[model samples]
Target: MKIFSENITVPASAIDENSHVNNITYLKWCIDVAEKHWLSTAPKQFQESHFWVVLEHTISYKNPSFEGEELRVETWVTLAEGVKSERSYKITRISDNKVLVNAKTVWCYVELESQRPARITEEIRALFL
Candidate 1:
């Protein structure tokens, strides 16, 4: 599968009282990256006909990240079958190259009008490849 990644500088506002990146901030980044990855390659017609909704999220915190640190956030689709896709995420500090967070999210494709689950087509799976 194709891997999408970008570097982000940790903002002061993203740090919580614990003096590190907040849990919610990390979660938000994971979702945002996944959305970007999907939209970057998925055709407009397919997007109009279907949308994805998160069914589950599993995140692990391995290390703490501080404000002003540059982090590498990476995401990729691990599997896309049936009506669901499993995506994985990894966040690491650029300085020490330490893994900060690892996460996986399961998203279900649903029809636009009826909001019912839709089967994954070969074309849709090839979009990421």
Candidate 2:
């Protein structure tokens, strides 16, 4: 599986009372980056055949991500099985390369009309390739 890596800055608004990035904000960033990467790299593929919806998410925070910190988020497709696919993310500090977060998410292919889990068609596989 290919890994996609991207960088982002920690915004002041993303900080929490603990003076670091809020837990939910980290999860949101993971989702945002995955969607952005898919849209930018395969817009037609994404629109035509299928969509991946999040089924479950597991996140572990290793270090505090403070305001003004630069972050590196790396996403990788682990596997696609049945109607579900798995992706993993590693969030690191850009300045020192310290890992700040580790996250895993399961996505299910859903038929738009029936709103049911659907198989990932060949077309969808080709897009992710």
Candidate 3:
């Protein structure tokens, strides 16, 4: 599978009371990277007609990240079938290359206007390939 990666700097706003990156912040980064990957790889027409919605997310916190830390966020589509695709994510602290979070999210394709689940066409799947 092709992997999409983005570098993110841990911001002060992302910190929780514990002084580390918050759980919700990690999820936001996952979703942001997924959208960015799709937008950059998929055809313009496909992007215009379809959008994705998260169906589920499974995240494992392996370590903590602090403000000013540079992290690498990587993601790839693992499964694409019917109307759903599973995307995986890994966030690593750049300083030590230690993984801070590992996650997988299930997303369903939907029509832009109708907002109803839409089938994954061959053309769409080919974009990921």
| CA-lDDT, candidates in order | 0.92, 0.84, 0.94
Provide the global lDDT of candidate 2 against the true structure. Answer: 0.84
Candidate 2 lDDT, tens digit per residue, 1-129? 667888899999999998989999999989988887677666584456667799999999999989999999988777777798788999999999999999999999877777788887665566565
Give a tens-digit lDDT track for model 3, residues 73-104.
99998889999999999999999999999999
Give the number of the best model, judged by lDDT.
3
CA deviation > 4 Å runs, candidate 2: 43-45
Residue 101, model 1: Cα distance from true site in angstroms: 0.6
Runs of candidate 1 exceeding 4 Å displacement: none
Error of 1 at 14 (Å): 0.8
Q: Write the per-residue lDDT of candidate 1 for residues 10-128, one digit (tens) a residue.
A: 99999999999999999999999888887888899988899999999999999999999999999998999999999999999999999999999999999999989999899998876
TM-score order, best first, reads 3, 1, 2
Worst 10 residues of 2 by lDDT: 41-50
Each prediction's TM-score against the native? 0.96, 0.89, 0.96
Q: lDDT order of candidates, best first? A: 3, 1, 2
Top TM-score prediction, candidate number: 3
